[model samples]
Target: MSFFAGIKAKWNAKMDKVLKIGDFDKQLTEIIADGVVTNNELETIKRLIQEYGLTEKDLNIVGVKAFRAAFKAMMSDNIITQQEESDLLAIKDILCVQNELVTKEMAVLLEHQELRNIQNGILPVIETGGILLQRDEQVHFLLDCSLREERVVRRSYQGGSQGVSVRVAKGVSFRVGQHKGRMVSERDVVVVDTGNLAVTNKRIMFLGSQKSFDVIYKQLIGYQVYSNGLDVHTSTGKTRQIIFDNKQFKADVLQLILDRVTIQ
Candidate 1:
């Protein structure tokens, strides 16, 4: 037998001995009443299942109450931490409640926790392009290349009181030059190679290009969706536009930005 099977057989044997005492419901209720299932409580539950030869139906009978109690404990503080979310999901799986109504209910909480992790930069967000760059301890949401499109960018520079003001037909860039004994500024046109976009819980990042920039989530004012791409507006009044080959990608990216930015 496999390791798990062997363990199951051992638990089943233990359970058979325990069933003779006939306190399964009482023991299960006691374990679940605290609204949290600790390691010992989980072991006890496993033993009860093994002893009673509990099938899915019997498991759900006990599981529904335990799931609710565990979920309530996690939500008691009005915020579910990553550990709590993981634990609850594990409990749901172990209780064989995967098909229960409570499973769907807990999914919302799990999704919220996932989004929360992304927003807090506790997760790594990644998008595939010509290259992939990732690090530990970062949240990366990868929007596939099916959603990316290329666009031509043009730029121009004009001298002003503030300095040389450079503007791009697409995004923004800066260039330094000397004119008439003063620092003359000119608009620097950016040439991007193998560009892709990614949104993390903390920021929106452009990757694999010289003009790559990371815009923090807090600085994002809003985004507009176009048939081919998306336009992201920052708090600085600058807008970055990205065109995707897929229209659905445009919509999905827009919705992702809206969902992420609104929560923060």
Candidate 2:
């Protein structure tokens, strides 16, 4: 038993030395998370990664796991107390932001590269030499803005049995009022303030009537620019033609966005 215990202890000591996190590892990750590290530290890490051919994706995944392990060790070793758990959780949230940003950048890069490849390889073949191709192929343009489904609460002029009469703005607004309030003139009812509103975005596709429009939408989606529905403004006037398949309540904007974009 004593001989076996000695062998196990020796193995553990050897493994710990090889797998320990060093100053370079923590410093590099801190800089990656925040830019506080000196420019030289940033360059050093960048150079080492470049020399070793390591990618951002590789670092993020590895860093997440390493930090999680470190956090666990800190927890177990009394390095961090119970009150510090919230602080660690907040750090984890910051790490999540980094993860999301890295993912978004990768997606944007891949999508743009794909678009370039398609324009180089497929577009010319279709435009110049493909069969049944015409000089004026009725160039159809599609504009895909980020259109998300939203709920617009409408207040009725008359109160019901419950005495609930208020409008809930779907988009961020400037007006804040209670459900039970005296009726004010239309002019007095201002748009809700952007600060105190319950506006949220959902991931969805928007379609306009053109190809260039579609490309724009793709770029906006990659960049996270989105809207609740179609906001079409022309030289003469502005019109919103939100397409929906609902047979009833076609006049309502909220219903239209929900019908066209969201699953009922």
Number of the top-ranking candidate, with TM-score as the measure = 1
**What is the number of backbone collisions in each predicted candidate, taken in the order shown?**
14, 14
Q: What is the lDDT of residue 70 in candidate 1?
A: 74
| Model 2 stretches with alpha carbons more than 4 Å out | 1-10, 13-15, 22-24, 36-43, 46-62, 65-105, 108-226, 236-240, 243-264
C-alpha lDDT of candidate 1 relative to the true structure: 0.62
Q: Residue 162 lDDT in model 1? A: 39
Q: Model 2, 1-264: lDDT tens per residue?
A: 599999999999756533433443565456444312344643565565555444454455455654455354444543343333433344444333264534533343344343344333322111222222234432111222322223344534544234434456766444344355454333332222111101112222233232111221112221211233333323333222333322321123232332322221
160: Cα error in model 1, Å: 43
lDDT per residue as tens, model 1, 142-228: 453222324434444445343455676668766455353344344433333446666655667776544567677788888776666
TM-score of each model, in listed order: 0.41, 0.28
Model 1 alpha-carbon miss at residue 211, Å: 21
In candidate 1, what residue range of length 10 has the lowest lDDT sum? Answer: 144-153
